[model samples]
Target: MSKISDVILRGVTGAFITNSGVGKIGMPAEHSAGLQQAAASGIPLMAKLPSDKFGTFIGYSEVGIGAALLAPFVPNKIAGAALTAFTGGLLSMYFRNPENTQADGIRPTQEGMPLAKDFFMLAIGLALMTQNEK
Candidate 1:
């Protein structure tokens, strides 16, 4: 594994841990409140946030820590090159064709996406997450 792969993996890990962790934490309360508020306001309450609040912690932490461990191994020459390339390709595909998510609507303050490795991989990982939902 080379230093570059470590860098990419760490970048990805850091991002996933932070944002996903926040959503995992804050979303449930907000979701409940939103649903209640929407019901009060006679609006359609789209409960995107489910009652099981802690489950996201497991997935986010697992992936973040997993990525951190994998980062160092990404430089391992045995399979580092191939893994990094695959991650890069997945990232590239997401960057090229980003699916504007409803989550983006929740917080409109975020800037446009960049060519950063983590976001690229996030697009890939997030896609995988969605796929796995089936």
Candidate 2:
């Protein structure tokens, strides 16, 4: 059985991620292009994909991860692993972009605050994965 905290965490994160994914699935061409360009800085392979395709792919991936998190039947470890991997990619993108960081290279610039906040999600994912079942 999952704790109330776990349920709340999963519900909130799942809904947020799912909505973001849905939005991306129908993203404007310019939006997709910009996102692809930014992602390419960290994952060079992303540059090879067409902007529309990239957007759809990312959307579907997020939806799947969100569904996993939302499903009570899904194991916490499995859902956490997915979230961790996704957030890791996001963090990588944030760190790889010089424009997103400050002079210290570790802190976020004004533009990077949104991405930097993903660190909290990463921490939550780690906690979910490591927590023992009650």
Candidate 3:
């Protein structure tokens, strides 16, 4: 990747992850909807854990991913791989909940749109991670 592309990827993804991580860590109350959704989705551990703790764990993970992507010393591929995996998990959760979308299933309802948008991040991370491999 070109220097500009590298910077753009790192900067955009870093900013987004940092913002989300900070919110998740700092504001548990605001994420109640997500907790409820998680429970409804029937994910094993997510439904069992206390919402605050679960949010905190997710926050920490996002923070770690953001830090890795933002750090100059970290390899782009490594950061990209982590981001890809993380967003994939988010996508999985979205898909697991049919109610998140409308009749078509492709179009997202208000509840599911956020997770649906993660595809961009996944794609960007995959591109950056694989770009240098030839």
Candidate 4:
């Protein structure tokens, strides 16, 4: 990869993931309500886990992914795969719950927009993964 491309990928994607991971780890309470609500909406399995624990798990995973990507020694493909799986779970929650979206069902409602943004994460992850195949 060109130096500029390397910097853009590592800098932009790494920073984004790192910030996300920090936010998740630092603010479990803020996300608890939405987590519980999603469980209530369709993902009954989520309901079985304590909200705080679930949040912590998510936080740890994000932190790990962020760290993996930011660490120079770690392979981009591994980080990309982890990010893809994480975002896939998020998208699954959004798609599984109709109430989370607007009348059109594809567009997210006010509550769903946060979840909707995972599309970008998915795209970023896929891009990183594909780049590594060359």
Candidate 5:
């Protein structure tokens, strides 16, 4: 691996390690509500995962996302990146075109988290990926 690649991987992996680690040791604070909603969406599917397993799923998810985002940089990086992305995407799906509609130009960031660029990011990110790719 090139030094530059090493540095980039180091930075990305470190961030994944930190955030995912938090999900394991504590919780993915910024992403918790989304995940819970995701789990709640699929009652039977999520119910199979015990309460204690929430963090485990989250840990593997973060690792997966970390690995995916790092896939181009390092083969192993896909482990974390894809995992977290799957979790994030799973949660994001629920947010997309939410069951309850919002007024024009308004999006909610959880119950009381207020609305901001994060909504744009969430929507844009969703659009960028979900859009038809020919």
Candidate 6:
């Protein structure tokens, strides 16, 4: 049996990520193109994919990860691993893009605030992975 707090955490985070993925599934070409470009900054291989394909791929990936987290049968460690990997990629992208950070290099500029906030999600993922099963 899962702890109430853990269940709540998974439910909230999973729903948010799933919703985000759903929104990106049919994103416009221009939007996807821009997102692809940004992603490429961290993972150069992303540049090889077409914007539309990349967008669809990302959307599906998010949905799968979110679903894993939401599914009670899925182990917390497994779901946490997925979330960690996803957030790690986002954090890499945030650090790779110069425009996202300020002169200090760690701090976020106005445009980077959204990505900066992903650190919290990263922390949540880590927490889920480390929590002892009751």
**Most lDDT-accurate candidate:** 6
How large an RMSD does model 4 have?
Answer: 3.0
Ranking of all predicted structures according to TM-score, beginning with the best and ending with the worst: 6, 2, 3, 4, 5, 1
Q: State in Å the error of residue 118, model 2.
A: 0.5
Show the colliding residue pairs in model 2.
none
**Candidate 2 Cα errors over 4 Å, as ranges:** none
Per lDDT, what order, best first? Answer: 6, 2, 3, 4, 5, 1
> Candidate 5, overall lDDT?
0.46
Residues 58-82, candidate 4: write the lDDT tens digits.
Answer: 6677777877767766666776787
Residue 96 of model 6: what lDDT? 91
Which residue ranges in model 3 land beyond 4 Å of their true spot? 28-42
Candidate number with the higher lDDT (1 or 5):
5
Model 1 stretches with alpha carbons more than 4 Å out: 26-28, 32-119, 122-134
lDDT for 91 in candidate 4 is 85
**Reference-based TM-score, model 2:** 0.93
User: lDDT by residue for model 6 over 25-115, one digit each (tens)?
Assistant: 9788888998899888888988999887778788998999999989999888888889999999999998998899999889999988999
Query: Which 10 consecutive residues of model 1 have the lowest summed lDDT?
Result: 106-115
Candidate 2 per-residue lDDT over residues 1-134, each given as its tens digit: 26998898788888888988988896888889998998888889889998877788889989999999999998889989999999998999999988899999999999999999999889878988998875
Window of ten residues with lowest summed lDDT in model 6: 1-10
True lDDT of residue 82, candidate 4: 79
Q: Native-vs-model 6 lDDT?
A: 0.89
Q: Which stretches of candidate 5 lie over 4 Å from their true place?
A: 1-18, 25-38, 42-44, 71-101, 104-106, 109-134
Reference-based TM-score of each model? 0.30, 0.93, 0.81, 0.74, 0.43, 0.94
